[model samples]
Target: MKTKFNYLIILLACLFFMACNQESKQLKQSQLPQNIDWEYQMAYQRGIEAVNWSIPAVSMICMRDANFGLGGSYNTVYWLSAPPTASIEALTANNQTPYASIFLNTKEGPVVLDIPPASDRTAIFGSAVDIWQEPVADIGPAGEDKGKGGKYVFLPPEYGGKEIEGCINVHVNSYQVFVALRCIPLGGASYKEAAEYSKNINAYSATKISNPPEGEYIDMAGKHLPTLPKYDDSYFKYIKELIDTEPLQERDMVMGGMLASIGIVKDKPFQPSEKVKKALKKAITDGYDYLEYMFETPGFSFIKQWDDRQWMAIREPSNDGFVFDEGDYLLIDDRGSLFHWATFFPRYLGKATAYLNAMKDADGNFLKGEKQYKLTVPAEVPARDFWSVIVYSKKTKAWIYSDTGRVGLSSYDKENMKLNDDGSVDIYFSKTAPEGMESNWIPTNGEDFFLLFRFYGPQESYFDKSFELPDVQILK
Candidate 1:
């Protein structure tokens, strides 16, 4: 009987080990690629994905342009890495005072624009303006030169133009002389590859000016303007062809390839398809088209009208205005300043709530005044200038109540701030009055609210990951 019991136990142990081995085999089979074709496909797909994201980094630098007036002639230039120099010719002898703006796209950046400081008496020619990375913002010397003339200057790569890679120059002169420059880097396999990319972009911009794509015509006032020139249908056809040629991949190889190359993935399992690779490229190109349409086409007629106005009056001290539903998104040109406007489409329903959340976390919460909320800025808030907190009503989507009387924090004098003994600051958000806290109180009125934390001349604390804001907490 003892021998029989021992035999049964041995038999059970063998069965268990066999089951474990079979399970392990199945797991390996599921993870391992079945063939070499799959491996090559995977690598190719990975390469395509990298191209997609990198392509935009290049295109943004290419398509930038700025116009001083509606009838003003447009001047444009492309930037490359090398010695930077730009050509400047006074269109008219009287138009000696020139103004220029630079635009750039960057991976780690608040893309900046430099403005020459104005003359000492005029205070409008020789100053630097650093625009934020958001869709739009501008900075420049204080005050405007209504009459004192300034000359338009162009800085191309290799000249005194700001020493940066992938910068473009768009110079214009009219009622106001302006230059728009952008400094976004282009990634490529080699110098030759980078040069080729730049050439293609220049060609595309030229083509756009001569032969724009066809789309419905509308005016700046959101109305269909009469006698407007129609776009060519061939552009649409070209876009369609590009889309049809591109095919979606079964799996996203871009992420996989990056992981494998970086050693995050010990072994790649499956290969990607050629169709998938093409699709990824097409998607990125399509994104560029979308951006162009939003900025250039009548599809965004409202934006065009706002642009025509040259971003005037929008920043007026007494223009307490609000847009509801369709009016929620207001387009304004920062005029090379550090405060630009953007509209979140589709995903955010073009609502202020969406725009607010999309900003950096230090800007604060979109739902602050919804019920009740708390915002705390650490002693080490990042900025070279000064910082301030501002509140905007979600319903109005405009800055209504703020401690500093401005929409964002500024580098104002210390007497204007209400700080704690430890150098920490606490701000309150509510619609009703907080007793003895009026100085630090931000009125919300039970409506959704947006907050902007502006840092003037932001320091390394803002960029090097050392500065962080506490999560917004709902007190109620």
Candidate 2:
């Protein structure tokens, strides 16, 4: 009876251990899929948000700092919001022509006018001015040429005192003008309150200018110009769905990893559930490995090889191979005289890589799949130097499809192209030559791809909504 009881006890203990092992396995498996899904969604969302936030944040910084914007030619415009007690007496003696309008609020009433010293005419006007050949215009005459010669209208304290709450409209052209509004509190107004009012006016002005959708620009090869993606209701809905479905712990882990990738957090102790911690480790490891692989990959090797000097050709003419790079079929020096300084050169290349990376399709293909496109370059595409269209493979970091034995299409090689009877050009993109169209073929390797439209010297058509490029469609 004693031996039989011992055997029963051992059997029960074995059964209990087996049951516990099964439960452990089940729990791990259940958590894994959810963790992975959450990781992917969270990482992608962070990347998208980073790009979105960068635009407004960079613009605001540029506006605040005179060291940036339009090659640093117009920093004084940002100083117009100074305190009321700040002396304009010194300003008047500087021989500075206050083309910008100033609004002042005093205890008695408001004042507004174009300030004095009227000899030096320099303000935030959009266009370039030929100040050498033509004499600077007076306030009355300058107002007429406001938008023409890039002469902006000034608002001064003599015209409107501290109580003013209105804008000065300076005509940029016959059809278009910008309004600079000033909102100031009455006399003995708190500086804090006045500052808040100024901020409100600035916000209002920004909203007005940002309206009116700027049409997308396309290249002759059918690639869209890099622009901010439209944020729509669908995008917000997608974000909401991701947040609701993903576990909070998993989301935090993913976000933390992404932040680490951008050097936001170098070393920090992070403790979460074992599963969440594992997922975070896997994501960081995988992302870095993939990027490393890409650097060594056939088409993407350029990213690893090209230095800042090589990329400078996209902005300035450096003897450091920018103008005479082997891959560049044509070089256009559209940079104006003001941009000749090296200190300001880096600004132009600021968003080039980020813009290229953002050109991806829904399927995670950067620029792959069969694509059909139509583009129109109107007669006399204006540029200071030249314009060219270049196609790049995100997978290869090189031009995907081209018979030119080059990466770019330039005006210098105009004679080499088979132009249509009407002086237009037609180019084809594919992995193989499409039947009879061998000469115009751009070679692809059946991977993701993108294209860049480099306008060495862009004219008004590039900025104005007049010239439009056709949309690209997936053929297959």
Candidate 3:
């Protein structure tokens, strides 16, 4: 009986030791740090929010800086003499039209933009935005002057200048403003003809309205202009410069406090400590990843224009002004997402044009660069002016460079491209051109890319959902 009791005691001791070991392992897995460093945590969180809020403004500054790098300054016009190519490193720039841009510094006084009336061969389509990238005036056929051209006077904040007769007055809250116009060819005119017509658009100070100085025009054809915002520590410096140069808006006071926490206060030098800098670096890089994640898994529903197709509107249809200003609050993530992949969003949406984006194929897979694909453009596209499809890198959001020197195939190329018996066209995308299909292929250069199908002067069928575009298919 004693021997049996000893064995029982030994078994009980072994069971207790095993139970203790399991409890210790669980405790180690759930261990907490001895203390929390709230400073780094707060800086990291606020820095992410600040980067999200500052992307649009930073993009504007980057464009202006790029122009300066190209030997052009404020009040100077830099226009592309042909369709944008890989040399033009802008975010989501179209390859079907020539672009004209100008940056005006209005700290001293107002700036006057003189737009010429639309001609039979060409017309301007674009908008002017403030330092905050808010549209102060849209100066194209559908803009302030309508089809007729006039002098647009952009008055600074709280300006007391007398209104000029027959002039469209735009009250702006910031001194730095940008004007970008697409010189579109009309009546099947060549892009070169549109480029020549763009020379008629000019800008001068309102002070010299009587005798305008000769405008400086810099043709940016074949020039390299890299204007994409960098996702790095230097981004904070641009924000600092912007704050120091422009007056703060009332709506941004709370955000300003957040900026202050990270050494971006107005009138104060931005020199963060090593600890803060480390936090900032982590915040911005990770924040960019987070933004990309949000794009992949969009919070907002994609507007499926066709029930059976996978093509979606490039942006949310209801987002007017690109500001995401809801009745009471702002849709911050939507605004950030739009600007992350594009620049030069206008004051209005889908009135003059419509853009559709296709990132996935019909079978619901992200576009693979190593694979081949095909898109079919039907005979009757619902566009009064024209339609185009351009491919951009999924990572850089810029043009894909290749030996062919082509980034898109559009309605403009239909005459040369092979068409089906029904008059529909098949455009291919891959690293190489298919046999006898060189004219209709856009090389992706082994990089994953997205498509922007634009319809200029969209017709009733487009808006009324009577027309539909087919989804891109794997070119097996």
Tell me how far the alpha carbon of residue 35 in candidate 3 is from the true structure, in angstroms, after superposition.
3.1
lDDT by residue (tens digit), candidate 1, 301-386: 12211222111111211123221112343222121111112211111111111011211123332364546655666776665434
- Model 2 TM-score (2 dp): 0.30
lDDT by residue for model 2 (182-279), tens: 22223444334433332211111222232522221111112211111122322222223223322223224554455444333433332234443444
**How would the candidate models be sorted by TM-score, starting from the highest?**
3, 1, 2
- Candidate 3: list runs displaced more than 4 Å: 1-34, 299-302, 316-321
Winner by TM-score between candidate 2 and candidate 1: 1
Tell me the tens digit of each residue's lDDT in model 3 across 183-300.
8888878888898877787788898899988888999988899998999979999999988999887777788899998889889889898989999999999889877776565344
In order, candidate lDDTs are 0.32, 0.32, 0.85
C-alpha RMSD (angstroms) for model 2? 21.2
Best by lDDT: 3
TM values, all candidates: 0.32, 0.30, 0.90
Q: How high is the lDDT of residue 338 in model 1? A: 12
Candidate 1, 153: how far from true, in Å?
A: 6.3
